[model samples]
Target chain A: MARKIVLIGPQRLQPTLAATVESLGVAGRIAAVTAGWEEREGEDRELHEHLGGRTTNLEAWTRVEDVMSADGELTGMIRQRADRLRAAHELYRLRLAHALDAARELLKREPQAGFEDLLEAEREAALRAVRVVDASHLERVSAIHAEFGAEAQPARRTSIRKHRAELEAQLKPCELLCIAGGHVVVLLHRLALLDVLGLWGERRPIVAWSAGAMALAERVVLFHDDPPQGAGNAEVYEPGLAAYSGLVPLPHARRRLRLHDGVRVGLMARRFAPDRCVALDALTRVEWDGSAWRGEAGTQQLDRQGHLTEVRS
Target chain B: MSGFVAELEQEARRGHHALEAFLRGRRFPVVDGRSVTFVWRGEADEVLLRHWIHGLPGGLPFHRVPGAGLWFLAIDVPEGSRVEYKIEVARWGERRLMADPLNEHHAADPYGANSVVHAQGYAPPEWIAHDAEARAGELREHAVRSQAYGGERRVQVYLPARFRTTRRYPLLVVHDGEDYLRFAALKTVLDNLIHRLELPSMVVALTQSPNRLEEYADDPRQARFLVDELVPELERAYPLVQKPAARGMMGASFGAVASLSAAWRHQGVFGNLLLQSGSFVFTDIGQHDRGPLFDPVVRFVNAFRRNPGRPAEHIYLSCGVYESLIYYNRSLMPLLSKSGMTVRFSESHDGHNWENWRDRLREGLSWLFPGPLWMVYE
Candidate 1:
């Protein structure tokens, strides 16, 4: 059976997770994941209260560490993946900066021949260059994941098998999975490593908020229009679990995006065109009901035309 | 002779009643130039007006009108001064704070209230009063199920008198909608503003949150419900301008946070924002003594300060100089401006309340929704 997944923005002031669980009628115990907190993962007392004490932490990070201690080759392979990913990100960062600068510069400059069509065509071409760079970076990251998956699973390290078995056992009695927010990359890493997504899809409802919400998207795009240093660009950090597609969850959007600038707002909408961009603030809940997306009253989406509109189910 | 004597007593009683009515009839504390006269009738050996004026201690005591059961006080004050005071009714050596019953206007604080006195050139606009000649807007109530909140909530929509389906109108959404309507006299203000062509004919939707504290605090589900459910319903029911720039969200205190949060999440939906005395409690800055209840608010503000996004195309942020949240709101202004958002900020010599928010509507709404004539003139 297909599972129900709800994504939201940040959950600081108003938490809808507990209410969401009750609404879903999942009265049984929930398997929880808070590996994003890193060292502070055990801090689930407040969360447990919200869930009526029907939650248990999966501790996937601890399991990952155990696996690394047990298996030398797998640990080495993991380190290699991390090093390569860093290098790829560093290289992509430089290219992306140059590509974006060129695009903006082209848009601002007047045509040498004074033909309006020439300027339009060149501007389109410049934008395409940025897309190309983005696409290329994604491909390299995808290849790395595929290679790791192909080699690691067949080897079947003892620690990995033990952890997988233990995870399945812990999840067996739980009727649902609740994901909390912290560090997006760390959360994503733990969830992916433990195969929690695969396990939950088979049975049980999935309710996630904040960073958890970001991890459900097709691609996790890190964006902050106004940063301490200066204007920042939106970058595709990593691929998401793709539990929910064609939806970009922008959490703490008030603190991040430059929605006032039509050029920037429109470009962002166009950059991820065909896919709708939704603001995932607190008390914001969107559920994929096996067909269409349903949401609350104030949930807004960036339309394909680069304008913001209220999202309807 | 005995019957005639009884008739004379009845006549005297009627005359005294008339005199009492006449004295209470006129607008209290009549102002002319710098001299203001306060009048009160019906027994009290000593009636004192306790005011916060410089060089006045224990208030100016009222003198009894000999053989009239009336107490009157006349004092000279500076022109263009607005004063808030309470009447101290002293009887049997006991004093009690009381509002001037004759004065229709009053300033309110969290602790009870006080009578308001506006000197010459310091009064609120006349347009705030309901005019018989003006056509009033109609308010329609609606209740819709929100998947974000997983419950049903009420939405009150205000349509201008000349609302027509043939044309699309801009949308103005307000949080704590009922409080604004009752306390701020929002409906009356809107009617006058629209009638005098101060602002455009707009469709205002006042949304009520089930859990105002929970819903207003940088919550994502609140944004989701606003955008996905409530908006779609509104769009279907009304002829609205289907663009972000034609829409706005407004609120006071936490409601301000909700307004900004909704706009921030869905910038494409709401292009304009009016925030009044927003509770942007930041731990990195000033005192955050609100404890756990404000933890999320602080976290959200901290995160925003770290990266203040330009959510709306035009933002009007107003704060009271006397409010505890003033420092935080002032600090937030720079971050918002730096986001490249066209920000207009103003401060008033007031505190966090509905009146402060009401006073701001004229400026905020006019600027955000300036009609054809204002656009051309300005």
Candidate 2:
């Protein structure tokens, strides 16, 4: 499907959200997903002002809660899935951390006797181990989704189907979809529940930043290098809508990642091999026009060798 | 009568009342009676104070005290207002601009020198000043060569008064070392904190940058020099904690970037990071950043977020509320915290300068090291 989306980094105080939407030239009614704001879901006044005051905040979290309240069985299933997911993620993170540590330590060792070839082999194996864990987690998640679909409970389908219809009705008049950054997991969950990607027609221009930008990727990767307390890991959390695939958007990259280390940069580039690791700093905007993606000045992509190269055109 | 008139009368009898009320030793803008006096000691026909008020520039003529070399002007400035001013001395038929020699507080500007007046409630902590009563630390200098940068850099090591070769201490590597040492009065602050048993006795290394912008803004070479060369040298010479959590990196502005970069490159090498008024410029953010200088910085910060491998143990971030970088720093706190770091954030009623960074050192460093966790006050 053709995709028309602009992914922004973080907006912080210097908000480029409104200007970005206006620049798209599709100036009409806008539908927004602000589930990322969590408790501050109704706080869309600032966003509305930026979007020329013609905005509708789809309270998708409320819809999810409604669906759960309507169907106890589905609610139970969701709770089970969440608990299992949390448990699995704990183990997955532990395994991934151990493997990554080993891989990094191996990379740190001084070269000796066919060390380049041997190191390459070891790196591949380490990456493979990490990938295996990620694959298994994805499989488990898929299985849960499969079971939910196969159950064929009318109430479950009806609850989701009604919400989908409501969301579609709300989106029908909107010319653009504006996604604001907040809690990624909440935003992603709400977007998935609302089936936003499915409802968002291919021709419509979509503007998103921060966590919202991350949710449009093929796989959402969560990362933070110098967190306050614990060491942050770049992990493949879950599958995105895949509406806009191939690039991983890192919002607030300056504050989160350790981009100065070539080894770390190269390792990240290699881990997500083939898919470009894109840096979406504040004011950075990248547009995907169906076939090819374009970036504004100062946009950067991680090269295979670990250096940050500017995104041209 | 009123408290103001009574205080005025009391001050009049004190002889050096003006100097005592306004000038604290040499610094100016000390409050006396509902007014903050700006004092300048120089030979001139006229001395004018130029500053902005309510978005408008205003110049006030300094009053030359009778038969005294001091030219003084008092302004009713609200408490906690940070203002920059330059003294325009009209002499030799030409007016000359001069920074306040007595005030050590100033903003970082490449254009011109301007002295900063930290009004009431905005002044830096009094502990930073050199106090004879406070036990001082010894700062030893060393010159180390870096194969990565292909240059020699000066590094100053601060050893706590009770330092012992047998006892291992946490190593804190500070970027822009000399600036922090000179401007921030870090040695004196460390001395006071350590003497008061507020902070644990730790080893501090202040490393001067060859070229701050080139080396600190996401430079792998500088990162290598820090993690590979400098850190190793320090470990060899001093009994330092080998664990990354036991090692710390501290710097203000670009130096903060250097510290973060080093810790990021060599994970498990540095667990603690104290970033004061860090110039964490991202590509799209920090509109007021140095155009070309911010290019690499933006790139590096972006990349780190994208591939955050593992976080440091304890990350401490402190920035001034009045600085331009405040928005950038505040935005970064949540992101860093979300990345799973035990982050302690603090803000000062100051701007992006050494004094601002110095003022928050006690809070930031104490939390990171928590050395005096068990210390009891007598």
Candidate 3:
């Protein structure tokens, strides 16, 4: 329910945070969440300087670490949730791998003479199977999150309540929320624990980049065409915060994905149809102004034909 | 004979073309699918191909072409295979080994250099080369006082580019560090992989032994020198992540033995290990035939095989299928897996050499300390 959500590319090589903020005419103290940085969450000096020293780190990661250390019951519940999430992800990954492999094999097969239509139908069916698997995984993750929320009732907890109140106080005077990229799952977990999204609901404009952008989508899809270990299949990681919908933000797509392989690009695009699979590379800036999405020049999205097309609207 | 080799022989028989002139413009070790024909043009009474490929003859006699000084040996090498060999030239009843003068590709080791041949599908990994775009890491030399060795041991520490004192990094102690740098191109690999985000920026301590054969062969002093002496010194000097999981050790051949032995002796100190072509020679019922140097190594490996005892949490091991030590490395995989350590084993169609070890670095290092590629999309 945010007023406006600005999604930027990775900040490591080419940081666009300051430029993006200035371009949007946003000023004053900005609230930043670096929970995704994990142990290095406290190291935000560079970010602060980039934002002209008007940034306040929310310290959501530190808060969770502290609360978990002090409250044993909350820690146990979080651990339980994590274990469940891991188990669910493993099961989903197993199914996803097989489904994706089947789809790829079908796509790679040469159609028999005059049987091209039949082969095309079979390929479509295979793609549908992969999409179904992804949907099922997202559904499972949503269930797990809902179950944990119901059981934990984190707002009512003593340790979490104290930290949440402090966070709310710190966020009250902030004009904008800046989220830096790191581990997407970790970022999502921290944001959920503190209910940061719930607190900032429709209050202020937000700017996020990399995993930060991915965490704002409806569904979080983890993709890597080639990894050191494993088959490098893209899998549905979990449900996102749904800050904005209809797009699966793929940061570092140029490096992590085999973009040149039309078959791979086409399958990924088709699998996540309806929701545009946007490739958010360096210096990219995309904005959702409460209604439609607008992108800067060089912004690209995967098309049905397995090619990168410029994002028009 | 291949068409090229046949043409060369025909030209030599015609006596119109000088053999040296014919060989001048052409490359040696001509590869045709899986068949590799190694050609040598020199004067000698007897010539032999000395190679280290397992399941093949140690020395293959090169057939001397009649009425020509050219010698040729053709062997069916599998595609993607990288073989290193030397040509043994015997003159006046004395034989001497030398690298193929005609072959420009060579891989150097601690002893000397050997001519290298890449079959149809083999090429050195792109990551092994120096990428101009990738910022190179800084290598600083340090001398650590070692009580175990009764002398000062020189160690080189590699600090990744854009390193900041404010940030803490993972530590990896590599044995035979100099050789890895010179022969395996470890620095360039580290630099490229780090820049690519395949591996996190790390602090690597490259340790070398003055007497590696004796020390690296599971010597207790070597283990003590590494864990007890070198690690503490490095930790105190550098801003390293003070956790077992963030620390790792790596080495190749006998150096691998050193890495494993150190981690095993000082359990919970290092959480990851990258062992390449480990000389883990051991005997089940009888003495090992690897001679006296392996006596202590055999004893240590035998005992370790019996009780691995969870030395580290994650272990990455790689060996060449063409190495004689491949059997031992393969045998240790099940043991490491059963010990509850997450183990990844990789095998390549290569021999026990530096390039083989170099090629496996990307896989081994990335698995041990994965970069922010998955975490940070940037």
Candidate 4:
């Protein structure tokens, strides 16, 4: 069966979720997963009102907290898994920094008569190095997850099963799933733990924005050209839920990434080749209809030449 | 000499006709690139540039135009620097400092006002201005009885726009509240930041002191008044978050000393602190050089260094590189970090003034109490 998905920009400042849903002609109950909100997980009054008060907050963060408190053994294993992921991420970050630096240095060199081809090849190699690092990190994270899955057997755990059952029951009546943006990892963790995707069924339409959009992709890449502290290198965080594939959603790209610098833009695009590097700024909307993608006006994707082009089918 | 200065000198030498017209047409303190030329068109025995920027000479002499009353001094200020100064004029064996007659820009403080010079790339932050789109927060004055002070203290509480009684909010207690409102444009900054989603819409308590120099010098009574009297009163009145992490304290200069002292003495009352250009004078060996006014400050800072405890979870400290107190602020960073507290230290090219403190508000407030922008985007 064909799946339907809609990706929107961040909804905090200028909420477009309701409008986007209406544009898609989607009506009925919306099962919202605001686990990313963390401490304020169930505080979705504004969201409910925006969606005409038919939104049922899943409260996945609270549920996970409850589960962790009640089940000590599972909590310990989860903590161990987190530590392993952290170590993996640190190692990935180290490699990514060096790779990105090399790529930047190569890109910084002005193109000369004879050195154009040579520099291009070197740039490609540097980009490949970044990709290799990202792939290795993703592989390690996937291995850790697989290992945890086999050992912990979350399906057999009574506490997880209870929560999963309740979530499934709550989701049964809802026609659409709306995921709000927040700390992507937290949202991923909660959603993955309860297996919300599995419960919702693949055929139902899903709408997500910002970090939520990133969470829906097959691969999650965290990018920020300039952050308050640190080297500001983009790194592969972890594999996403694979609700959608073949795209890297860069939310708040205008604010976070230096889109004007062709070198950085081209490097990012080439590094994540085969997958379109989409810039999802405010008021951006894109839809996937099983086979191809369609975008509204002002939707942009990073091209091989580093220029922002209209998103094409 | 700069081209502009040379041109003015040439014009003065040629005749007074063009020079007078040029002076009338153009503004003083001509900023070209990084070079700023201060022009004074008056007769005097000598003219000097008196500025508050540390490391630079306190007074730089202005050379006469040779044949004209116009005196000029060109100084190279770094990019994005805001300098406050006065023109010291000497005549008839008497010297008096006065604001530049040609410069209209001025920054006012408790003492008085100083003529302002904005070098290349220095502009007040856009967020500091009043935005019509941003909903304004309400500032209500309250009189709280203080046992420590043995009197009634007036505090202005700022409740965010669309404030709900059911929903609780984080509280930020600000020292020198009236001064911040007047000079720093605190209310406008808060409204804009909150509206922009760069800062969470939270309650702010603006406090003032009858005698700040004495009281804000890390007085125990001041700390007791804040942590014990003011906080409890605010908690009872407003729907403030009860936990320590939800509460923050902020102040500049001597007020910073009071904030740190209150947090230190109370130990876990305020989880966040925003200290700007703190007058944290300390002596490593002998007595300090800041005179008697900083005596209490030096004592408290020295004590804090000796046994630095975990006063707050997060501390945002900002200081101007031009201020003499930068060294002390830099010294305190390591101590605070070593005490197992999350510390973010920032330094600007400005000075220890209200505007400098105002410029740092966005970073400090946003980091301490992040809004939906950070949460949703990252």
Candidate 5:
């Protein structure tokens, strides 16, 4: 089966992306890491204190440090499973070779005078006799971390940054990173984290959505704010994220954020890069394959309406 | 075999990706994909309307839950009627000629309109058209006035389907224009009543309220708004008698109150009176006794003793025991009868809701002018 990316609606999809990074067990090659958890102080003060009780509930903050600790275990399991599958396939191939030898030695008349007749007579009989591997053996080698459930806690935020030079001095292999919505807000913090892990010098896959989706582009925009409301009626506020331009070659969410920005943003873009345009609905996506990045996003080629566009055709 | 139906469960399990994507900026684990709904939540709680939007351009499918009868999806609808709907099925597409198995309240589709009901407790009416056309005229400018007080308002009008430009027809005013002409399907009612000779061939003006509460309180402003605006507006659209006795007023609830008040204040303009659950004791409501409203009812009653009035030659009053103001209706009935007002009083065991008032409207028509069941005004 192919590996797939699952997404929820724009609002909820943010936390899910965060969970995947936690599971990876590495935030670059950084030696130390910390994550801010969005939380609410509740009626029960004890529960609040225990939000991220290290060994008990790692959810109080981002589990970058705890995640790195599990990296060795996951890497070892993956290698072991890959080796086991290769060994099993090799053993099966050896048995077939032995059977081929037996059939050839018995059937050859004048030292392979006629190949077709020998194989039809010998191979057909051997295949009927063969019954090799069990179903359980294949299943064991093929289990992909199948199920994951994510729960939403109240929103609390903290930032973690790492020293790139130190991380590079210690790392041996590479890693991948994905970001969305909330991640976009704290790009500077992420850069600090990524820089420390820069030691790996390995290929990284970066996927961003909404704000996180927009930050990967040349610039970032703040789209929403609370409007004038009546007494007791409050408006919700969503601050904008920092911007970063350089990344790998992939169809990422570059132009998608602008699809929802509407007309005003179009004028803003014309002033900035008159050349660089954004999609209207914020549905832009980019994909990179190591060397070069290719992307498809944005609503209008003529005007700059920074709305997000839909992902699928 | 398109296998579209089979794909539905798979599509749902996959979070309607086959339909649309998740919001950007959110990581959606597989488990969170379930329990997603498209309709926006939160709004005022005045009226409840259940609709099927599964049809393209947005729709809710007309699907039947297992073991549950048709009305599995119903909402709580208000008493007033000015509703729109389109039947939507998953695979077949949006059906214009859809029927409501839940709502017993049937309205007219003058502009190929649709029938709808509240999402819950949707019981289809006994007499809904199974094969009616969906293209019906639109509903507009249909409110009636209250006569007892001077400051109340409402929308109501009478329309003769095949009215001749040169001819004039006797006008028949019915309470609750929305309920009678729209929800109750008065055009169809008149079609049947006039053809059978159970009622006369007359123009019907179904009354409506401004705020409903304002109309019920017997506010004089609402009354003027109705007479000055609604009556003239309906008259321009449909041929109606400008004189009082030639006109009729009818309603139930505050609708009943408004009808009595309209005739009380403008008996010279509206002669016939039809009251269902009329609140005659305006003393309780702030609208009555404001300036000179209390005098109109008493003076009308006293004036009836002398000349018996040219406008009130025909009057009908009916109330249910469960209604809050039925006693006042009962008390006023005796006084109107003593004043030589030709009053037709009826009693039924029901509440002050649409169902009771609607049933009384059916009776009021018969009592006023007995005729064939299908002698329509047109």
Candidate 6:
């Protein structure tokens, strides 16, 4: 998470992109795109009037039909899904960074010896916990990393004066850049941010929307298929981090859904795989005040597609 | 409530049929049982089966008119519908159906539950569906919160009965918390079994040592974390019996050795030993005194080889007869038999999977508690 860049959500990102167009913001220099939704469909997603620690809400979802153009809605759906996966990956990496921090902190407690002492009994005491894969698969993971090939590194450290001079040259600071629909660009941006952060050891705010959102995690397994009605993607899940943690970033949810006309929840349920969620309607995001991540209104939440009922009125 | 459609008891017996109470009141016993051949235009869900015998507690156990066990009391409903309901055994006496074995949300009390046919199908809570979708989005949350490694498989929290703000409970420390949560179905079992009053009111901390090998072997750091970190954290959150005898340690395979060794090393902390499918041959590590592998559980079994005032009062050791490690499982059985450690052993048809372990969990909990009725200890 390069705090310099953040994407709010698809709808919010749309308006933010517009705002960027007017004021030449961080995302203004770079193009904003989305794979899950077409231009029209992507435009329909709204921006949150507010932001905070609240969770995925039911009121924030915009139907795929409403978001994308009629002719290219299907393609838009595929892109949206890919975008989500990549965004999830970015989020996972951000979390890994946090877990590494926590794991490091545990070392302080058991400074005398092995890491076994650092693994809190409470970690194991959690009656409700899940084991992803084991150490046996470490080699496979390494191979997967190798398959991706060695990524290029950022510029190295210069003299203190030179570094300060470069910082002075780069006077314009980093701001949050949110994107929706653009799966590849979004993922590229996340990778770029992660690498930049690793090189400089700096933390920045990042809020991504839709595909951009899903790209924030560890690995983005693409789920790009033509949705019958809506503009969204089918997501496959994988492991990324150790605990439930992250800065809460809220995304505005849209009203009404398209694909399956409203039955996508069940499809999303069975297909979302392990450690994943569809988070309809509302989704928010927030900042961390050291200890825990807190959310404010409209910041982050999985908006529910309100339960259907027959009303007395 | 209008959003909630009801679910009726669906029997699938060979030659019986179901009758809905609502339909019964509306129409005649349309499909009479006496009629050799009967035909009715009814949706499977619409017909609620009532198995009512004449003189029973809830007048249950009678057959439906034209259906059998495993039949669905279906209704003409759309695929996206959510509903809930139960069966009403409307007969003339005290004999009532125990409860639907298939239904996870069953009666808290099997012996006595009002036979009010609740016709509601399985409708997951709002949070479940939200989190179900949000489960994907929340990955960042789980990954950061946990210290395991890359990601989280699942989160399994065991909320014991007395684990409210009012009372305290002891810890029945366990390893491989993930397997216990997924395969063992500890929460569901604890909920139902406790309702049945089978096990004692204690907390079992099903855990997993990220460093499984060393933790299961002779790793003091792993042991210290469980005792110093895990124990106190659980003590803060849950209710515990607290005393050494009241506390226990249990596991299978490496976990089995870990449990026994943990108790052995910290004798006064853990007294009860539940070793299942343990590999105690010591052939792999034959040189290191073979003690770390075999000493703890064996010491608990022999109690210093001279009945040392029974260090552990309750001990349960079980394993599949056809298991790869049956030698270790069986050899220790006879050795453990000497102390009359309130043992009950059996051979089941399943191999080494969660299924076998799940079956054993119920039996083990029952043996531990024995309920207020079958008080073996007293």
For each candidate in the order shown, give its overall lDDT on alpha carbons: 0.77, 0.76, 0.89, 0.89, 0.40, 0.39
Q: Positional deviation of A180 in candidate 3, in angstroms?
A: 2.3
Q: Order of all candidates by lDDT, from best down to worst?
A: 3, 4, 1, 2, 5, 6
For residues B341-374, what per-residue lDDT tens digits would candidate 5 score against the true structure? 7888887544444555555655676666554221
Task: Give the best candidate by TM-score.
Answer: 3
- Which one is best on lDDT? 3
Q: Pick the candidate with the highest DockQ.
A: 3
Candidate order by TM-score, highest to lowest?
A: 3, 4, 2, 1, 5, 6
lDDT tens per residue, model 6, B136-160: 1000111112232334323233655
Error of 2 at A151 (Å): 4.2
Please tell me the TM-score of chain A for candidate 3: 0.96
Once model 2 is optimally superposed onto the true structure by TM-score, how far is the C-alpha of residue B176 displaced, in angstroms?
A: 35
TM-score of chain B of 3: 0.95
Query: Which residue segments of model 4 deviate by more than 4 Å?
Result: A12-19, A27-91, A147-175, B12-28, B41-48, B55-70, B88-105, B126-145, B156-173, B187-205, B230-248, B263-274, B282-291, B302-318, B326-347, B362-375
Scored against the true structure, residue A207 in model 6 reaches a CA lDDT of 42
Per-residue alpha-carbon lDDT of candidate 3 for residues B78-189, written as tens digits (9 for 90 to 100): 8899999999989899999999988999999989999999999999998898898789999999989999989798999999987888779999999999999999999999
For residue B200, what is the lDDT in candidate 5?
A: 48
lDDT of 4 by residue, B242-300 (tens): 99999999999999999999999999899999999999999999999888999999999
Which model is ahead, 3 or 5, in terms of DockQ? Answer: 3
In Å, residue A50's CA in model 1 sits off its true spot by: 0.7
lDDT of 6 at B289: 46
Candidate 5 deviant stretches above 4 angstroms: A1-313, B1-158, B173-175, B181-183, B282-311, B372-378
What tens digits encode model 3's per-residue C-alpha lDDT throughout A1-313? 5489999888876888999889868778899999888777888999999999999999999999999999898788889988999899999888988899889888778899999999999999999999888888888888988888899889899999999899989999888999988889889889988989889878489999888998888888888888776788887889988899888899988888999998899888988888888899998888998777888899999998889998877
